[model samples]
Target chain A: MNIVVLVKQVPDSGADRNLRNDDNTVDRGSANNVINEMDEYAIEEALKIKEAHGGEVTILTMGPDRATESIRKALSMGPDKAVHVVDDALHGSCAVATSKVLAAALGQLNADLVICGAESTDGRVQVMPHMIAERLGVAALTGARKLTVDGGTLTVERQTEEGYEVITAATPAVVSVWDTINEPRYPSFKGIMAAKKKPVQTLSLADLGVAPTEVGFDGATSAVVEHSKRPPRSGGAKITDEGEGGVKLVEFLATEKFV
Target chain B: MTFDLTSEQDQLRDAVRALGRRYGHGYFVEKAKAGEHTTELWAEAGRLGYLGVNIPTAYGGGGGGITELAIVCEELAAAGCPLLLLVVSPAIAATVINRHGTEEQRKRHLPGLADGSAKIVFAITEPDAGSNFHRLGTVARRDGDGWLLSGRKCYISGVDEADHVLVVARTEDAGTGKLKPALFIVPTNAAGLTRSKLDMEIVSPENQFLLYLDDVRLPADALVGESLDAGLPALFAGLNPERITVAAMGAGTGRYAIERASGYTATRKVWGGRSIGSHQGVSHPLAHAAVQVELARLMIQKAATLYDAGRDLEAGVAGNMAKYAAGEAAALAVDTAVQALGGAGMTTEYGVATLLGAVRAGRIAPVSREMILNFVAQHVLGQDKSY
Candidate 1:
């Protein structure tokens, strides 16, 4: 089986504050690039399956030249190979534009399965994989918490607000992993060294038969219209004293609706 | 030449963090208290090539180095499942076998260690020796095509769970002008060998054991590397790896503690419904500790690289330095996380306090913080030997 994991280079969510600038765009300089958190889960899940059943894992990502860093990280995580889409126009692009570019890149690779993170940490819009599925005309599963692939049969469990929903799809489908799924793995030193030699094929929009007019920030469906800092909160009343005074607080709570 | 980790290393960091978060501190705390190993986490880590990060690819390993090994431990410890066996199994035993063991030994043990199917425990520290490695009393005498070993070892970790133990002992007759140290692979179930559990007060999943070798015999091939004549160099090979692994364990523990504290401080509410993190009282210390942890992690990577590059003594110094820094950083990070969590930190359900005792061991066992400082003072700083 051949599996392709869609890894995105995003600013580390924990360090996302560094990416903010007065212009309302992600400050590229201060932003440390990393694989999307959820996509890491997808890559880990894919590796787990490949380890159990003999297969090759191919990592796919569409971003600038630096995005290959995320792909290399995926490859180091034991992926057999990788594909990097290096187009300057993809910078500051929305999820839709990114998905369209990735779909074009992935279209050229032959794979039995494709997996992606449910949402990129930078833009939590959560629409990339679904849009990729539509573009590629493949069955799509979103928010998968658990995934198992057996002989071209795919079983996925998705977390819902109320409970969970389990769905099974055929081979050659797309899966967008949610955060609740299996924990992703850190690249071991061996993976890192070996990743240096692993094949990472690079392509541009023209290589995948994609026209320049259909890509870039203009192609993105969603854009930030306005941005502002969250106002600092006001102070609260202090509940002073203890013991008998605490009992008085309980009595006060009884008089209030909190009781 | 880049100072940052390679892309793959970055991916590994992200992946291990994600996987570790799945079970997290709550699960690890329960397992530690019950004295049960996190076999689930260990198995998953092994499958993902996280456990044997440094073992060679030909042996079913990731073909990485000590840096990967350290990353695995740091990531797992950060995720709350710091497996001491990761240090013992692949880092020490498997590494020794792969480097020095005969082809059969490497072929037999490497795959299992890499896949987590077989576990090998490392035993070197003895009660009598007590860090004075040359003073160890364990002796192996030649028998009929085998060796009869007799001695005792203390504070050996995870012997009960090991398939075999790589025991460090002296071989050949003592008074015959032939005095040298040797290593032997002793099956844990070998007859005439007895192991007793040490009732440690700490709550680590891996327990220490006292090993007694009473006329225990092993095959001739069990002696790793060269014969008794070339002892010290072979012994140091295994010992150096052990030290580097300890450093990795410290890195993992520190990462876990910092993550827990950072996550809590980032969003935890306080006065005026604002995150308590906005207050200097809470945020400043965390920031300080974060710097310390990062500094220790840098030392850990440097040590791992030197070790992987086969710079032995330099690697030793780096390992000791990294281990010392990481031990302190992990303990402080966990303690700070607990404090930052306020009331929730103390609760068993919260799981931060469990790491407190576990991280403390980094400063106490394998090698103590004082021991590391002493080593640095004497060896690196050219100070007088105090110990």
Candidate 2:
């Protein structure tokens, strides 16, 4: 079995984040960039499948040149190889456009299975697997909390508001793993060094048979018109108790309809 | 020539930093206070291959050199769970074995070191030898085909956790009629090997041991290489990485301190909701410490690069200097951080004070700051040997 994991590079989650004023996109330099945290689970899940059966794990990510960091990080988690779809023209891509380009690359690579996080922390566009699956005309399982794979069948425990639903799909399928699936393993020092030698095939929009006009901002079906920061929070009320403190608290609570 | 780490190194740093954050200072202190080891973290890190990074690829390692291992050390330290064993075990012992061990020994130890399944602690410091390898009292004399080794080593770290010890002993070279440095792989469970723990004040999961090897007989193959003569160069090879990794640990602890202080001062308001960080008094000292730490880190990078490049002589000079700079910087950084936190800094809950003794201890151990200065004074400054 050959598996490909889709990952994304996002600004450090703990760092201060800001958006570009000119457009609605995030300002990349506001902080450091790291592999999207949720994708770590995807890498872990793929590694688990490889360990259980016999197969190779390949990490697939799309972004600018620096996105290679994401690929290397995922590869460090014991992926056999990587496919980095890097191109400046790929910026400002919508989830649909991203899935199309990724599907094209997956098509070129002949991936038997594709796994990814349910949602990207940066984009929060949970439609990655749907778009990729639609494009490839393959089955997709999203929000998978538990997963198992057999010879030609893949089973997933789809998380729901009620509980969980077991879903199974045939070969050449896409699955979006939930963070609860498994704890992502830390990349060993050897894994980090060995990742340097692992093959990373870089692709561009053209290389994936994607036209420039059909990718990036122009190619997207939907785009953010504008984005703004949330207003800063104001200080809350602080009370001083000199006398009748209990009575004052009761009065205030009653006045605020809490009592 | 670029000061910035490559994209790959940056990722390694970020990943290790994340790992460190997962097991914060709280966990580290709890284990230390209970006199327990950070077994989970160590096992996880080792299993992840963070430990044997400097070992060769054929030995089931990452094929990286001291440069990568130093990064791992610093990142872990920055996360407040500094793994001191990393310095001795992988950085020193693994490098020595890789460079000087026979193929059989490498096959036995290197793969385990690479995967973190096996650990090999380093023992060179002796009660009488101190910093002087020439004065080492450990003697390994041939008894038939094997050797009888006897020595008392002090300040050996993580002996309890180690499977084997790369013992630095002195052997008489019959060919040259001279006493030269020799290395032997002594099993920690060897018949005559005994270890006693020393009480330490420093807040760390690793413990120091006083090792006594009395008439410990070893097989002829226990000697690392075929020749006992390839001693000094092999010893120096391990020392360079040791110094570099220790510097990385220092710089990392310094970073940990500065970050803690900065976080506290940024939020802890005083005098009418004004952050204390607004005062020039607290901020400048932290800033100065940050500058010094950055400078030391740059030197560490240079030293590691030189060592990785096989420029041993240049690496030796730089590694010594980097260790000196980093030791002082860590002490300074920790001190400044404590001052910035005022009373909160001393509070154990704040986690800043836990590093104080450890950072100060950094100046005196593995190799003292004075020894480094003496080296620089003699080698770089063309001065008379002070020691």
Question: Where in model 2 is the C-alpha error above 4 Å?
Answer: A29-31, A56-58, A81-112, A134-140, A150-153, A168-172, A197-220, A236-259, B1-4, B175-177
DockQ of each: 0.29, 0.64
TM-score of each: 0.78, 0.90
In model 1 chain A, which range of ten residues has the least summed lDDT?
Answer: A16-25
Candidate 1 regions exceeding 4 Å error are: A1-60, A74-82, A89-195, A208-259, B1-4, B173-176, B258-292, B329-346, B369-374, B381-387
What C-alpha RMSD separates each model from the true structure?
A: 6.1, 3.3
Interface RMSD of 2: 1.7
Across residues B287-356, which tens digit of lDDT does each residue of candidate 1 receive?
A: 8778888898888888888888888788899888888888888788888888989888888876778777
Measured with C-alpha atoms, the lDDT of residue B149 in candidate 1 is 93
Per-residue CA lDDT of model 2 for B1-387, tens digit only, reads 544677667767777888989998899999999999998888887777677777887888877778888998999899998899889888988888889888899999999988778889999999898888889999999999999999899999999989999999989889887889989999999999999998888998889999999999999999988788677777877899999999999999999999999998988887897898988898999999999999999999999998888889999999999999999999999999989988888999999899988998999988998898899989999999976
- What lDDT score belongs to each candidate, Candidate 1 first? 0.80, 0.88
Best by TM-score: 2
